[model samples]
Target: HPKFDMVMHDLLVLLKPKFVVMDATFAMEGNGPNRGIVIPMNLILASSDLIAMDKLCCEIMGIDWTDINYLNFVDQHYQREEAEPQIIGEKIEDVTQKFLLPYDDLAVRAQRWVYKNYFLTRLCFGTPFLNMLQGCLNVYRKVDEEIMGKEWVNKYWDNSLPR
Candidate 1:
């Protein structure tokens, strides 16, 4: 699964932009931007450092920065030990409050249970059908590889096959 901050980092790397703005007016909590509950907040955040912006967003949403995997990964990878982010626009204490976490504790527990169970995933994705499809694709690839390896087959069949 792609983390939010990692996606943002990749975008920044590709675009090499000067600044980033994030809308935290309605942000997610507990389980996230998609699946979690949306807390109505009136907040706007911006930063040159995407990681700091993400950390600030999480903080505004009442998420513990340590619990967020993306921030942890960035900090570890970059070895940025002293990268303390400065808030410029608004004071955190004045704007943010403990918004409700998306799902109740019981729902979160159930979701975790379903996620950890192998059978649940298999059932969702149809394991046997997927296996069969993968097997067929592998067989086709092997046949193509063998045919391409033979000099005569390469000269003849290469003309027939689509590039």
Candidate 2:
């Protein structure tokens, strides 16, 4: 995670915003930061201290701050020790909620790994014809389901259509 740490350090050094404000009115859960279902919780958070802010956000998210490498990077670069961040408004316990983590299926893990590895992704998808593979896969799955008389797709579509 060196590259991620480097990027974060550069941003903090360059921008140097005095305070950070976060809208916790809704937060994403399950396979995110990105790509997850949104959970609505009416809350707002603000703090001048970056580490403190992140720590509190993690607390609110019910995740361990130390588990995030970038948070560790912040701790080291700022020489700040872990402590109870000075919470200005409501106590964190009042707002905290457990979020579901990413789906742990092997296919999901492999898909994510392939996506993160640029060389593998390019090798698989960069070819002129191969670039259309994802679209083709979707088409094939649909066709196969229909041919096999799988009724779930129709059920889902019927339920989801404008009523």
Candidate 3:
């Protein structure tokens, strides 16, 4: 939660974008922002308000906006009473589709638990630990590719994308 909050809120304060737009035509589900199943929704979302945009995205995905940790933090920090955002295009209710979330049931609970716990957050995000954690993940990815084959490695990884 610390890392997510840092990136979502704190970093935004330092480096705010002029606008935010998301391609929701095919949204990812299950352990997202990484490996996940894609669902076709045929919609595009855009807003100057990042928080509002994100909340609407979650709603369109048929998930509770509050279920996301960073969103909850933003909601509280901003003192938001309602989750409604001004709709400029398609109505969210008309396009809502339930997406299968990431991780097993136990893993989901464990993830939430870790995010909510201060001790766990410190252990995961403190000082040089985050860098070390990233390094470990990199090593794991290399090992996974070698063992499982490089089917997921993109042609663009080395700037060899087909024109």
- The residue-by-residue lDDT of candidate 1 on 88-125, one tens digit each, is 76788777677665565775676566667778656535
Q: Residue 72 deviation, candidate 2, in Å?
A: 1.8
Name the runs in model 3 displaced over 4 angstroms.
33-35, 78-84, 104-163
TM-score between model 1 and native: 0.51
TM-scores of the models, in the order given? 0.51, 0.63, 0.59
Model 3, 1-163: lDDT tens per residue? 4377656776567666557988878888887766788888888887777888887788777889888888887667653334455797677689988888877667668767877888886686666787997999999988998876465555335646586
Worst 10 residues of 3 by lDDT: 76-85
- RMSD (Cα, Å) for all candidates, in order, is 14.2, 4.8, 7.1
Can you write out model 2's per-residue Cα lDDT over 34-122, one digit (the tens) per residue? 57889998888887777788787888889998988888886778543445666677777988998776776786777668778888767
Clashes of 1: 0
- Tell how far residue 40 is off in model 1, in angstroms: 1.9
RMSD in Å for model 1 = 14.2
**lDDT at position 13, candidate 1:** 56
Q: Which candidate model has the greater lDDT, 1 or 3?
A: 3
